[model samples]
Structures are given as structure tokens and as C-alpha cells.
Target chain A: MNETQAETQTEIALDVPWNVVVHNDPVNLMSYVTMVFRRVFGFSKEKAEQHMMEVHQKGRSVVWSGGRERAELYVQQLHGYLLLATMERAI
Target chain B: MNIERDAEGGFIFSDVEASLAAMFRAIPSAADPEGSKAALDRLFPDPAAGKEAGLSAEWADYVRPELREGFENASTTVEADLEPLNAGEDGWTIPRDHIDAWLNTLNQARLVLASRYEVDEADMNRTAPYPPESERTLAVSQIHVYGLLQECLLQNLE
Candidate 1:
């Protein structure tokens, strides 16, 4: 309502962490997903392969967790590689 | 068909038959998601996964176009590389730099075909060597071929 209250709400929203998750796709190759992870997030080969395996064995993997804006950017990069990725506000 | 690395670390596919050449030429069109909503949705997925309507709308207006442009550019690169094949050549060379574009374009085509045909892991494993009797079967074959191409690029990339 008031400027101070609005500013407080905005700050609260900004403070909340968000997660970038990549979901499993029947079409995307494991090696391809691993490569995308390496390129987009600069993940190491082992780290990227670990997450890729998680995504393959499980349904999804939380590849990154941080500020909402960064999470959104990561999701954008993942989507650019045609991976099934999303950003969600962390509880 | 056989694939080998060129002197500059690029990939050269030799002995590409007419059918394989045809498949290479089809990459650009197969990557086009205009006619299939499923393919389009898979390519430009909602980053928020439907949780935030505002974010979804913002993504559609601001981000989707950029993504589409990137896909088109990759497809263009692949199409340009296939010019020799289009001109009745037996094979084409993927310069080291163009590897990413080729991989991306091939992936796009595979995803589009998979989405359109509802292909799953089972479909991918179906390698009976039977002649494709239906459109769906042909699409499956195409997906496999495109996937093999992607794998070839990845192996060379590594």
C-alpha cells in the first residue's frame, strides 16, 4: 500500500532463493545434456555427468539454486539448448 | 556412410548415399516447429513451468523470440553447410567451428520429429530393420538418424 511497505515486499521477494531444475526428456541424449550443462553452467565433466545421470534415472535434477534472476537466466540457457528446464521459487 | 576428422579437426562424412544425403537436406525443414504445437512447446518451454502467469507472459513476449532466432540461426548454419549435398555432392564437411550449429540443428530436428510422432524410449529402441511402412515409422527412422548424427558430432567434439 504505502511506499515503505511496497519496498519491503519487493525486498522480501528478492531475498527468496530460486532453483533451476532440468527435467528428463526422452529425446535429449545424455551426452548432449551433459555438454549443455558444461557449457551453460561451466560445470565440471564429473559434475555435469552426475546431474545428467540424475535426470536420466530420476525425473528431474536441481542443477542450480540461487537468486531468482540468475535462476531464470540459467533456465533460459538450458532452454536454448532444448533441455527441459525450469525455474522455481525455493521454499 | 563413414565419418572422419579432417586436417583442421572438422568432421567429414564420406560415402553418404542418396538416402543419407536426402536426410541431411531435410534437417532444416524437420527442425521447423511451425505446424506442431507440441514441438513448439518443447522447444520454447515455459521457464516457470506454469507457476507464474506473469513470468510466463513476460517470457513469451521477451525471451521466446530470441530463442526462436537462435534455433533458426543454427538451422541456417547447418543448411549452408549442406550446400554441397544439395548440389548433388555425396557428402559434406562440418568445419570444427560449425560443429555446435550442426549438433543444435540436428537436435532440433530430432526433437521436433519425436514430439510430432510421440516417440518414446521404446520407439527409439525399435530397430527391427523393417522397411518403414507408415509415416510414424519413417519419422522414427528420421529421429534415429538425426540422433546418430548428433552422437557423431558429440564424439568428435569430445
Candidate 2:
């Protein structure tokens, strides 16, 4: 309610980091997966490919880790684009 | 076109074009073509009985005439040989290599369409003004198609 309290709350909220993970699935093509990463995360082609490779080889990869809210948003957007995406707290 | 959410909470597109981009990616290439073709055939068989059932001319125009005719011919052939291959149980079982070739063809089509329509990369990224229902349908189809593809590939592997 108070200004100081509200300010502190905002700062605290910004401190938490969230992890965004893209799970491996059977259907989506590897190239298409990379393209989705580039389109959603604005990653360079190389970086996107790298992440996509990680998913292909390892079954899943943490494409991103950041604030919980933003991570959720990324997961939602990726899901919207038909990627199997999820989020969790980064330990 | 408008989109609607079905009882299952999945998105349904008023026009197939909104979902075609993602659908086009499901076809397999030579290396992984069988699964891709199978998926494509499952979704778009020749004659497209689903298309004929109750589709509008506007929706029909979403399909390229040649592609439409190809589907029809393919479906008919598959139907004619259904007993031998059990093809009628499903649709045509597209070989993976053929699917891959189809993907290349689709990419070329996209390139040509982009140029013809003057669709810039930036413009493609810009949010198109779609009805909420349509947007939801696009979202659902995009996710469902990818999920289904992943499932089919896994099934083949098993």
C-alpha cells in the first residue's frame, strides 16, 4: 500500500529467475523447431540451431531462463506456435 | 476468416490457409519422408471428402487448383486399391521421401507467394488483424499439428 512497500515489492519481484524449456516431441521437424526458436526468441540462426540440436539430441533443452512471468509468456507463445514448451524455477 | 474454439478447447480455423504454413512442414523429406507423407495424406487426401462435405467456394480457393486436383486423383487411386493395401482404413500412405519433396515444393510456393504478394518478413511478423476465434484456431492448429507430428514419428520409431 505504501510507496516504499510497493517499490520494494516491485524490486523483489524482478529478482526471481524463471526457466523456459522446450520439450522434445515426435512430430515437429528439426529445422522447423529451430525456426520457431529464432522467430520467438529472436535468436540468431546459429544459436537457434544449437538449441534445436540440443533438443533433438538430448530430448529436451532449456532454451531460456529468466524471470518467471516472462518465462511463462515465452512458454505460452511457444505453445501458441505449436512447440511443446514449459517453465519452472531455475535452481 | 474467423476461428472458433471447439468443446475440447482446441482452435478451429474458418479458413485452412491460416494453418497451412505449419501443416506444410509436417511432410517428410527423403531422409524422413515416410512419416511426413503419412501425416500429409492423413490430413489432405485426394478428393478431400471433408472438403466436399460442406465447404464453401471461398474455403476451396484456399487450396491451389493443381494441388486440389492432385489430392483428388491420389485419393481416388488410393480408394481403388484400398483392399490390397488396407489404404481405406486410413488414406494414402505417403512415403517419407515424397513428403520431403513436397516440403521443398511448399517452400518454393511460399517464396513465390511471398514475392507475388509482396509480403515482407517484417510484415509477416506484424500481427494480422484476425478475429479472436480465428486467432485461437490458428494457435490450436499450430500446436496440434506439431504435437501430432511428434507423436506420429514416435509411433513409427516404436
Candidate 3:
């Protein structure tokens, strides 16, 4: 492809959003999950608990949605805390 | 185990088994690259879902090293804190700053036990009592002990 086409494709790729999700697991405690959510995303107690509840009740929660790089970073951070987390391209 | 917060806000656990503290010290070395793959795999699964093999590989390549570093750090923190234990005192103190480290390490230990026992999510939560002397019963008890520890840390953290 030509340079202009390559540059345009790069920009489009960069604009595609990704969603960072945490899946509920039987092993992790609810409180531990809440604390991890607060620590990683800097969510307030209420917000973090809400997401924790969502994961508990709904099986998964979209904790963040934004640029792919940032989403990947968030997923990695969650995994570091041993949270079951993943990222997917936004539809 | 009995847990309470000190005046400085750090957590102290009374009745912590000397054996358990030794186990924490052993976690970092227990992560043998070959033997511990199954446990590590569960702890840090492929971040991408479905048939996205290429994406999963790319993500793993980028993230695995950092995850390894995190595991080492957690194990080190727990070891340092437990260094004072000499088999006499069945207890340990977790400074407020190292709470996260303790949480991560304890959770990892639980995951490793679950992996070793071949327990699924349902089995881990199975309230049905195993025969009292069975290894499964012992495994279940250990897992719950880790859960209680995590809960105590969370309560004090708040």
C-alpha cells in the first residue's frame, strides 16, 4: 500500500477502542476483587463495589473501555493482582 | 487465624502456623518454569477470549514478563515479613504498605492449591463435606483459610 494509505490505516487502527473486562471466579473473594478494582483503576469505593457486584451477579464486568494500549495495560495490572481479566476490541 | 490492626494500622495475625509461614517463603522458588506451568497458566490465563490465537500470543509476549516480576515481588515481600518467624511464634505482621503483596501472594497460593487438587470452581465452593481424613477435605480447608486471610486484609484495608 502507498504511504498515505498506510498512514490512514494506522490512524484507524489507533482509533479502535478496546474493552477491559474482569470475569468472576469462585476463588477470589468479593472484598479482594473490590479492593483490586479500586487499586488498579482508582475507582472510588462505591464505583468499585458496583463493578464487583456486577461481576458477581452478571459473571463479568467491563471495567474500562478505551484505547487498546491502555486497555491492555489495565488487563495486565488486573492479572498481576490475580484477577481473571481480559481485553477485546470494541465492536 | 486471629487478625487485628495495630496502632500503626498494620495487620497482625495471631495463630499463624509456622508451617504456613514457611510455605509463603517457599512460593517464589516453587514457581518452577516447567512443573508450575499448570498453576501459572490458571493464574494468568490468555487474556484474549475465543479463537484469537494471534492476539493471545501477542498479548502473552507483552505481558508475561511483567506478571513474572509481580509474582516474584509478592513472594519476596511475604518472605521478608516472615523472616522473623522462628517456629516458636505462630504469627506474622503485615505492614499496611505490604498488604497488597500479602493479598497477591496468598491468593496465588490458593490458586496453586486449587490447580494441584484439580478442583473446578464448583468443587472449590462445594459445601458438601468430604470425609474428614481425606486429602480433599484438607485442601478445601486450606483454600478457605486463604479466603479468610484475604477477607481479613480487605476489612483492615478499608
Candidate 4:
């Protein structure tokens, strides 16, 4: 590939957003998951419950999306709450 | 067993019968996920979900230990809170300060029990009683009871 085209591709890869996803688990209480989302993300009650319900119904939900480092940090906090969470490239 | 709220917003589990007390006392042990690989995996899941091996390994090396330590600390707090029940008292009082620990430890125990038994969503949703015929059945009961306790704490905190 051309030099500029390669650089553009490299920049795209470097700038790719990461998503913090929470997967549903029967063992974890729905209320508890909502609480974690609220606490970790400072999400409002309505917003937190919305995402919690999404995870519960859909098996998983991207709870947060941002820089890879921040996504990793959010995943770490969700894990601290014992929720099944992971960070992945948005693409 | 009767659960009530104290003036300080803590839980007061009074008249806890022997059977329930035994269950409560077992919390610390049940919370330990060391023996079962599945339980350990549940407690310390990969942060990158296998997509990034290096990130997952770094998490295991550095972050997993912190998570384990946090779980252990929560269990310790719960164990200390159960002293009254441990000392032959009919009931136990969870001080307001230790509410979060109790919640965390109870959740940990439930997760461990569920993992050890290979419990799934259908099992959790089962309405009929598990025929108490094996250790696996007993683990199911433990998970339900611990789940109830966690629910109580969450409701009270609301």
C-alpha cells in the first residue's frame, strides 16, 4: 500500500474506540448489576436500569464506549462488582 | 429467621435458627473460590474476553490478585460480623459499616456455589425444590439462601 494510505490505516487502528460490555449471568442479581452500573458509571437510575435490562434480555450490552484505557478501567470496576464484563474494540 | 433494620441502617437478623446459623457461618468458606477452576474463573474473569491475550495475561498477573484480595477482605469482614452467631448467639447484627462486605461476600458465595454445581439460568429459575439428594442439590440451596440475603441487603440499601 502507499505510505499515506498505510499511515491512515495505522491512525484508524490506533484511534479505534473500545467498548466495555457486560454479559448477563443468572447468578448475579439484576438489582446488584444495576447498582454497579450506577456506581461505576455515575449513570442515573433510569439509565442504569436501561442498560441492566439490556444485558439481562440480550445476554450482553455495551455499557460504555471510549478510549481503550478507560474501557479497561470500567471493565476492571465491573469485575470488582463480580459482573461478567470485558473490553473489546468497537469494530 | 427474622430480618430487621437497625436505627443505624444496618441489618439485624434475629432468632436465626440453628440451620440458618450454620449456613451463615459457612459464608466465609463458601466464598473461597480456590478449589474449583470454574469458580475462580467466575470471580476473576478475563478483562479482554480472549480477544487480546497480552491484556488478559496482564490482568491475570496484576489485576486478578487485587480482585482476589478484595473478595478475601469482604469475606473477612463478613466473618467478623458473624461473631455473635459464631459465639452461640441466636442471632447476628451486621453493623452499618459492614453492609457492603456482607453483600459482596454473600454474592461471592452464591457465585462459587453456582459455579461448583454448574448451575445455569434454567436451574436458577426452577420453581420446584431440588430433591436434596446430593451435594449438588445442597449447593443449590446455599445459592438460593445467599441470594436471598443479597437481595435483602440491596432492598434495604435502596
List the candidates ranked by DockQ, beginning with the highest. Answer: 4, 1, 3, 2
Local lDDT at B115 for model 3: 73
Off by over 4 Å in 2: A1-14, B1-158
lDDT of 1 by residue, B87-130 (tens): 98888899999998888898899999999989888778766764
Compose the digit string of candidate 3's lDDT tens values, residues B1-158.
57788888898877766657655455444433337667868777888875568778886787787888888788788778876564457777889888878888888877777776776778876777788887666666777766777787778676
For B1-158, candidate 2 gives per-residue lDDT tens digits of 33444454333333334244334333222112133444343222322223324222422354334444553443343233223223112222334323322333333233223333334434344555535665333433443444443434323422
Interface RMSD of each: 0.8, 15.7, 1.3, 0.7
lDDT of the candidates, in the order given: 0.90, 0.48, 0.79, 0.90
TM-score of each: 0.95, 0.36, 0.85, 0.94
Lowest lDDT block of 10, candidate 3 chain B: B25-34
lDDT of 4 by residue, A1-91 (tens): 9999999999998799999999999999989998999999999999999999999999999988988878888888888889999989998
List runs of model 4 lying over 4 Å from the truth.
A1-11
- Give me candidate 1's TM-score against the actual structure: 0.95
After TM-score superposition, what is the CA distance of residue A70 in candidate 1 from its true location, in Å?
1.1
DockQ of each: 0.84, 0.01, 0.74, 0.87
Q: What does the lDDT read for residue A16 in candidate 3?
A: 92
Q: Chain A: TM-score in each candidate?
A: 0.92, 0.82, 0.91, 0.88
Q: List the residue pairs that clash in candidate 3.
A: none
Could you say which candidate leads in DockQ? 4
